[model samples]
Structure formats: C-alpha cells, structure tokens
Target: MRAAWAIYKRELVGTFCSPLAYAVMVSFLLFNGVVFYFFMDLVASNPSLSGTRGPLQLFFGSTILSVLTLMIFCPATTMRAFAEEWRSRTAETLLTAPVTDLQVVLAKFMGSMTLYAALWVPTLLYALVVRRYGAVDWGALSAAYAGVMLVGGAFVSIGLLASSLAASQVTAFVTSFGVIGGAMFALGLGRYVFTEESQLRFFSYVNLWEHMEHFAVGMMDSRQVVYYGSVVVLALSLTVRALAARREA
Candidate 1:
C-alpha cells in the first residue's frame, strides 16, 4: 500500500510537472469553451428547443462534438502512462522495485484518472454560467458529471492497458483511440441493427449514447454502473497481467 501510494504521488507530480500536460489541458479547455459558446447561443436563440432538458444536460452528452472530444482527448490523456516509462527506460527500474504488478498498475491508473478529473473541474464553471440564465437542476448536473467520470474511468483503463502493451506513447494513443472509438460506434449501431427484443435490450443496456442520455436527465441506471465498473476492472486486470508478462520476459 505504501509503495502504491508513493508511486501514485510520483506519477501525479511528474505528470503535472510536464509541459505536455499543460498543453493538453489548455487545448481541452479551449475546445470545450468553443462548444459551450455555440451551445449557449443555440439555446438562447431557441428556448423551446431546450424543452425539459437543462443547459448542462444538453451540453454534457447530447452532441456528437462532446462524444468526439472524449474519443480524442481521453486517449491523449493516458497515452504516456506506461508507454513513456518504458520508452525512457524508467519502467525497468520501476518494475524492479519492491512493488507488485497490481500495485503498479493501480497507481498509474489512479494518477491518470486524477488528471482526467482535473481537466473537467474548469468545465463546472459552465454550470455556474448556466445558473445565471435560469434554474439549474443540480441533481441532473451531478448525474451528468458522474456519467462523465464513469465513462472516463473506462476510457482511462483502456488507455492504460494500451500503454502497458506498447513500447511508445504514439502506439499507445493510436491503439486506445481505435479501440474506444470503434467500440462506441459499433455499440451505438447495435440499437438500430438488432431487431429482436432481447438483442435490442442488450445493446441498449451497453450503449454509451443511451447511458449518457439517461445520465443527462438524471436517470441513474444500475446496469450502467455495473457495465462501466466491469470495463474498468477487466481493463485493469489485463494491464496487470501484461506487466507481469513483460517482467517475466
């Protein structure tokens, strides 16, 4: 536990100290700001279109742009975790230390998730801005944020697994981007392609689009909680195994 905590702190500090982290943070904020501006303008011009949905609800996961942003940026956020360590020969030293593979994987994962969460803190101001215009649904906003974090945790775990398997950050990013993007697209299409009731039900249960829409409206489904938790656990387990295999090799 002490080793994991120490490694986690080291990873957090090292990541924050890097120029690339700041670069990504600024780029993410800039992109989200532009999207929020357009969203606000659209809502202001067509108030009726907003209907029952709050500004934050429509802003969180109702648009293709938001989905695309996550597809691109989540991979970017985690690409350097294990891949950078390996590329710089730091992984060798780290792996030789008095730490279990699970601890190492968990430490890196927590560090990456912390950074990912920090990226979203500034976006909360959007909620404050929305509050000035009208009544904000605090419950729905909280649910939307929870959905974002759950989705982010799954994406981070996938990216971490990719990083563990790759020797360089570029490979890690590309692999994770493809997996996350492809899964989102494929699962989304399942709702339309599957005709049977059971099949459609299954697809809808796993669909990220449906999950986000529900979360945006403050409908917290237990199935979604389970699905995202499963993904994180599965991905982290694979990462630990990958690390052990590399150590043995």
Candidate 2:
C-alpha cells in the first residue's frame, strides 16, 4: 500500500509538471464554455427551452462536453502509463520493486482519476454561474456530477488497459480511442436496432449513456451503479493481468 501511494504521488506530480496537462485543461474549459454558450443562445432564441433551466439541461450539456473532453484528453493522459515506462526501460525497475502488479496498475489508475477530477473543477464554476442567474436543481446536479465521475472512471480504466497493450504512446492513444469509440457507437446503435421486447436491454446496460440517463434525471439507480462498477473492475482486472504478463516476460 505504501509503495502504491509512492507511485501515485510520483504520477500525480509528474502529470502536473508537464505542459500536456495544462493544454488539456485549457482545451477542456474552452470547449465546454463554447458549447455552453451556444446552448444558452439557443435557449434564448427558444423561450420554451429557456424556461427549462434546471440541472437537467446543465447535466445533459455537460455530459456531451465531458465525453468530448475525455475522448480527446484521456488518451493523452494514459498514453504514458506503460508506454513511456517501457520506452525509458523503467518498467523493469517498477516490476522488480516490492510492489505487486495490481498495486502499480491501481496507483496509475488513481493518479489518472485525480487528474481528471482536477480538470472537472472549472466546470463547477460554470455550474455555479448558471445557478446564480437561472433556476438550478441541486440534487439533480449532484447526481449528474456523480454520474460524470463514474463514466470518467470507466474511460480511464479502458485507457489504462489500452496502455498496457500498446508498444508505443501513439499506439496506446489510438487504441484507447478505438475501444472507447466502438463501445459508444455500439451502445447508441443497440438502442435503435434492438427491439423493445428483446432481452438486448441487458446488453445495452453497459452503455455509459444508459447508466448516465438515470442520474441525469435525478434518479439513483442501483443497476446503473453496478454497471459502472463492473466496468471499472473488469478493466482494472485486465490491466493487472497485462502487467503481470509483462513482468513474467
């Protein structure tokens, strides 16, 4: 546990020291601001939507922005998780250390999640500003934030798994995006193609959008929680296994 914390601190400090983190933070805030402003403009032109100023709109708007933000930044953030260690010949050092493979992977995962949460702080300011001028549903907003964090965890896990498989940073980034993009597309297509009466609802349950909808509407669904939790476990478990294999090799 101590060793894991050491790795976590190292990763966190390393991430903050790099210009990449700053670039990602700026890009996220700018993209979110532009999207939110556009949404506000659209609402202004259509008064009916304007009156709907609760957390639901804010959440839905933020979810779209978060997806885009994660898609762009997660790869960059995770690309170095294993690929750089391999490139620098540091993997052997970490692998031969007293830490277990699980600890190493978990440390990296937690570090990435910490960075992601930091990136999300500025969005809270935007939410507060919206609340000052418009009606806000605090309960719904809280739930939505929880959902966003949950989805972010899942994405980070997927990215880490990709990083484990990749031989290079670029490969890790592309592979992470490919996996995430495919899952997202499959989830959307499943909703349209699957019959309402079919048992495919079980399969669609894996979709981040489906799980997130419950929280966006202020409902805390245990099923959705389990789904997201399963995703985290599955991805992390695979990551541990991948690292173990690398160590043995």
Local distance difference test, per candidate? 0.88, 0.76
Question: Which 10 residues in a row give candidate 2 its minimum summed lDDT?
Answer: 53-62
Per-residue lDDT over 40-90 for candidate 2, one digit per residue giving the tens place of the 0 to 100 score: 666657777655444346445335554666676776678778887888889
Best by lDDT: 1
lDDT of 2 at 19: 86
Model 1 lowest lDDT segment of ten: 61-70
RMSD to truth, every model = 1.1, 2.2
Instruction: Give the lDDT of residue 207 in candidate 2.
Output: 54
lDDT of 1 by residue, 1-249 (tens): 999999999999989999978988999999999999988888899889678876677778677776777777888889999999888989889989989999999999999989999899999999999999988889988998898899889999999999999988899999999999888556866998989999999888878877788888888877888999999999999999998887788
Rate residue 110 of model 2 by lDDT: 92
Local error of candidate 1 at 185, Å?
3.8
Best by TM-score: 1
| TM-score list, all predictions | 0.97, 0.91
Question: RMSD (Cα, Å) of candidate 2?
Answer: 2.2
